[model samples]
Target: MEPFVLRGPEATLSTPTPADVDRVAEVCADPEIATWTTVPSPYSRADAEGFVTQMVADGWANDMMFTWAVRPPGEVDGPVLAMMGISRTVGAPGEDQAGEIGYWTAPDARGRGLTTAAARLAADWALDPEGLGLVRLQWQAYVGNWPSRRVAWKLGFRSEGTLRQFGLQRGVLRDSWMASLLPEDPREPVEPWPAEAPRP
Candidate 1:
């Protein structure tokens, strides 16, 4: 599939390139990122290179995923502010089409709403008939990832409760919170949620 770019209010989302290796390595190396995400611990230059070169390439080629590197608007060549993607999900027999969204924000770019904006853009694109035309977009995060949960909630994903030992982080099983956004759901925030609600 040919690569494409999606421009949003605050950021531009595009395919990752080999040129982004160094910056990707630097950002993924942050302990906070490693702890919260599945990114390799003690991330290395080689890992970053493969992520941009091999992983992204294969994902697009196979139609299994679509990954985008987010940057400030009009700064497509600038440092990556975050990485986001939707992966096609292999559902059970007789299930509707589905995909799962995942993302990680750069440490320096936290609290700027860049990821949220980019996520909305991606979700819109994924649900468009001209795009992937997926029926629903799933979201999951290890329990306690309030930031990620907030992003999902802000996008109107219905909280679907928790999955026990749903994810593995560094060889340890961890519970995860799950949610879903359907084509019929409003993109804006829905009913107010409890401030103390558990997060994925």
Candidate 2:
């Protein structure tokens, strides 16, 4: 796997730096974090910084995937305000040519459509052959996480199915909604927004 670049309408994607862990930890500590993600409760700066180191090293040594900090557009020299990442493939080294998208926005950045725009930007890049050599992007969200699913649909992911007892979250087995965006249809009907359904 090779390094790739992805950019959002309001943010640019880059490997997360240690300095970014503080802000990222704050985002992870948001009350909304555990509601939608597998992120652990009581998120700490150590956990945050470790993720940066681990994710980057994994991307290179294990060819797992790349993670990036999403910084506000035109403000390229500060700590990232959010995070968005994509896996290189499903499980093994290489088989599916598909990637899983995940993201989180800072508490102060909520309601600004940051994550939505960032997700769209990631999908666009991953679907490009020059980028991840991906043919599809998969998104999964906990049931009732309308915000997350909305971003996926806005970015052209079709609700494909649901995974029952998929995994544990906050000590409970939960159902997850799954969706996909194919490379063939790269144009998102709606500009990335916080609410609404996928345009037919």
lDDT of each residue in 175-195, candidate 2, tens digit only: 988877888874564334334
How far does residue 69 in candidate 1 sit from its true spot (Å)?
Answer: 0.5
The local lDDT score (0 to 100) that residue 178 gets in candidate 1 is 89
Query: Candidate 2 clash total?
Result: 0
**Candidate 1, which segments miss by more than 4 Å at Cα?**
91-95, 194-200
Q: Which candidate number maximizes TM-score?
A: 1
Candidate 1 displacement at residue 127 in angstroms: 1.4
194 Cα displacement, candidate 1 (Å): 4.2
Which parts of model 2 are misplaced by more than 4 Å? 1-5, 91-96, 189-200
Error of 2 at 173 (Å): 2.4
Error of 2 at 120 (Å): 1.9
TM-score to native of every candidate shown: 0.92, 0.84
Tens digits of lDDT, candidate 1, 91-124: 5434567899999999899998888999999999
